[model samples]
Target: MQRKFLDYFLFDKKDNGMLETLYREDETSFPPFDTQEVSFYLTPEKRLSLKYPAGEKQELSYQGFRDNITFILESPFAEYFEILGSPYLDLEVRTGAEDLDLFIYRRAIDENGKTVVLKGNHGEPMDSFTRGCFRLSHRDEVAKDFDKVRVICQPPTPKSGVVPGQIYRVIASAHTGLNMFARLGHV
Candidate 1:
C-alpha cells in the first residue's frame, strides 16, 4: 500500500491581510511540492482584497489592465492532488452587484521549452454568489509536470455600470487529500 499525503493552506483577511507562502515551507531545500504564494492589500473593513501573483507573465494587457490585481497559483505536483481525490482549486467571489466576470488560464512549458496556454470555459453567469473553479491538469502530456493558474476579474466595461465604492471578497480553498474526508467523519 502507498501512503498518501495531502497538504493545504487557507487564505483569509487575517495575518496582516497578506496571503503568502513565504516561510510556510522551505523552498530552497527539496520540497514535496511547490507552495502557492499570493501577496495583496486588504482594506480596513476587510471586505475587499486584491492579489497579483502573476508578475511579468500576465497575459491581459488591455486599456484597463491593473498590475498586481490578478491571482496566480503555481503547482508542480498537480497530479498528486488529483490522485488524492481533490483535483480542483475552488474560488469564491462576493461582490455588491452581479457585474463581475472571472477569467481563468493555465500556462505551462512543454518539453521543447515552448509555452502552452489553455483558457477556461465559464458557462452561465453567477447568481448572488459569484464563484469559479479551475483544474490543475494540463492537456499536453509534455507540460503535465506542473501548472500555472491565473485568475483575473473583469469589471463591467462601462465605468458607470459598476457600483461605487463596492467591496469585493474572494475566498480560495481546496481539499488536498483523502485525509479531508477522514477529518470530516471524526467531527
Candidate 2:
C-alpha cells in the first residue's frame, strides 16, 4: 500500500507562525497537533542525506568570489521543531577546501512584502568541518522572528580571491522522534 503523508510548511512566519497546511486529499480527521521535539542529521558522503522524512540533500560548486553560495531548507516539518530545545541540526562537511566558512540565516518577510534573508546572530562562521552538531537558533534582540533557515558556504572574503574550481560536499538532516505529540488534521 502506498504510504500516506502530510505536507506542512513548518516555519513560514509570514503566512503562519508555526504550521501552514499544504494539502489533504482525504477527509479523515486528525487530532490536534502540538509542539514536538525533532532532530536533524546532515551528512556528506557518496550523496547528501537528510534524516527527516521530507528533508533534502544537495551538491554544488562555488562560483568563485563574485557569487554567493547558498542552500535553502524549506522542509515540510520545520515548524514543529525547536532549535533551542531537544531538536537540532547536524552538519557534516565531508570534503571541501580549507578556510571555507558556513553562515546560517533565517528567511523572513518584511513590511514591504519583500522576502529578506536575515543573517544568523549565532556568532562567528563555522570554520571547521570536524563533524559537529549545531543549533541554528538566533538570540539577538533586534533580530526578526522566523521559522525556516538557509545556509551559506563560501570563502572568507573577496580580498582572498575564490578558488577557481572548489567543490564542497555536505549533508544536513533532521530527526524528530515519535515520542513527541502533535495536533493531527487535514488541510
Candidate 3:
C-alpha cells in the first residue's frame, strides 16, 4: 500500500516499539492499545481504516501534508510497536520523521499465508519501466505456514510479462517481523 512510514519502521525483536495499525496519516494522534487503538488498513479510496482507542473501528482520510511536507498525522509515544519488514530487503531504520509512537498494526494473515508489504521500489523512479514489485511464494500450499512463506523479488528483466514496478503494497495479513532467514529466490 501507499505508506508514509509503516514500511520503513525498523523491526527489532528486542526493540521494535510499534503500536496499532492505523490508516490515515493523521492516525498517529489517535488512541493506543493499553490506552488502545489497534491495527489499520487502506480502503480502495485510500482512506485509512483503523481501530480507535475505545476499541472501535474507524475509517479515515489522508490528512495530507503541511507546507513543510511533514505529515499532519502524529501520535503520542507508544509503549510498543511491531514494525514489519519484508523478506526481500529488510533494511534497518535508525531514524524516522513520522511521529507515530502509538497505535501499532497487529500482524495480518490471509487465506494465502502470513504476509506483509510495508513499502518498496525495485528501481529508480525515472527508469521505472524496468522496476519490479515484491512477489510471494509458499513452501507448502495447504498449511500456509509462516515459517514456510516468503516474499521474493520479481526480477528486473525486460522480458518478464508483468508490468514493471506497477505493484505496490499488496501484502496482506502480515505476520509481525521479517523472517530474515528465509531462503529467497530470484531478485
Candidate 4:
C-alpha cells in the first residue's frame, strides 16, 4: 500500500531482529500447498478470488495466498518501518467468505522444492498493481503482552470489502515514538 514514514525512529526488537521479504522484477511462480482446487487468482483490484472451494475447507488457496504474503513483505510501509521478518507477521487477509491460512514464511519455495524468493534482511516494495491504501484498526488482534509484533488488517467483509468503518485506530505504536516535526519533515 502507499505509505510515507512520517517520522524517523529506530525500533530495536532486541536480539530478535526482523527479516525482510523481497520482490523480484521478474514474475515468480506461486507457492504450493497440498490441495485440490479449480483456479487460484489475484486481481489488479487487490481482490483475491478463486474459482471454487479447494478441498481444504478451513484453508484458502495455496498458490495465490503466497502472492498476498509477497505483497505484504514487499509493501513500502513494511520497508520504511523495517518490519519484514520479525518473529512473525500477522496479515489479516480480506477474502470473500473464504477462510484461508497463509504465512510470512522463512522462504518462498515452489511445490517442486525450488526456491523462488530467498530470505534476506532487506524489505522490497510491493508491486504497484497489487498495492493500495492501508488503514489500521483500533482493536489489536494479538495482545500487546505477546512476544511478537502482530500486524493486523481487516478482512474483507462480504458487504463492504475490507475497508474499515469510522473510528479506525491507526497503529499508534510507531506514532508515539516519532516526533511530530520529524514526521512533517518527511512530508
Index of the highest-lDDT prediction = 2
| Model 1 vs truth, CA RMSD | 19.9
After the best TM-score superposition of candidate 3, give how far the Cα of residue 138 lies from its true spot, in angstroms: 18
What's the lDDT for candidate 2?
A: 0.30
lDDT of each: 0.29, 0.30, 0.27, 0.28
TM-score of each: 0.23, 0.27, 0.21, 0.20
The model with the greater lDDT, 2 or 4, is: 2
Candidate 1's displacement at residue 55, Å, is: 16
Residues 56-121 of candidate 2: C-alpha lDDT, one tens digit per residue: 665444443456433333233323322322222334332234344444433333334344432212
Superior candidate under TM-score, 3 versus 4: 3
Q: For model 2, what is the alpha-carbon lDDT of residue 33?
A: 42
Span of ten consecutive residues with least summed lDDT in model 4: 178-187
Q: Write the per-residue lDDT of candidate 1 for residues 1-187, one digit (tens) a residue.
A: 0111111123222333123322232336432364444233322232223443333422222222243243322222223221222223333233343354444322233334334332222122222112233221111221222244332333333232334235433333232322111111000
| Candidate 3 lDDT over residue span 90-182, tens digit each | 211111222211111322222233232332232122211122222222112212333345543333333222233232223323233322212
Question: How does candidate 2 fare on TM-score?
Answer: 0.27
- Provide the clashing-pair count of each candidate structure: 0, 17, 27, 4
User: Model 2: residues >4 Å from true position, as ranges?
Assistant: 1-35, 39-58, 71-88, 94-96, 110-113, 116-187
Instruction: Show pairs that collide, candidate 1.
Output: none
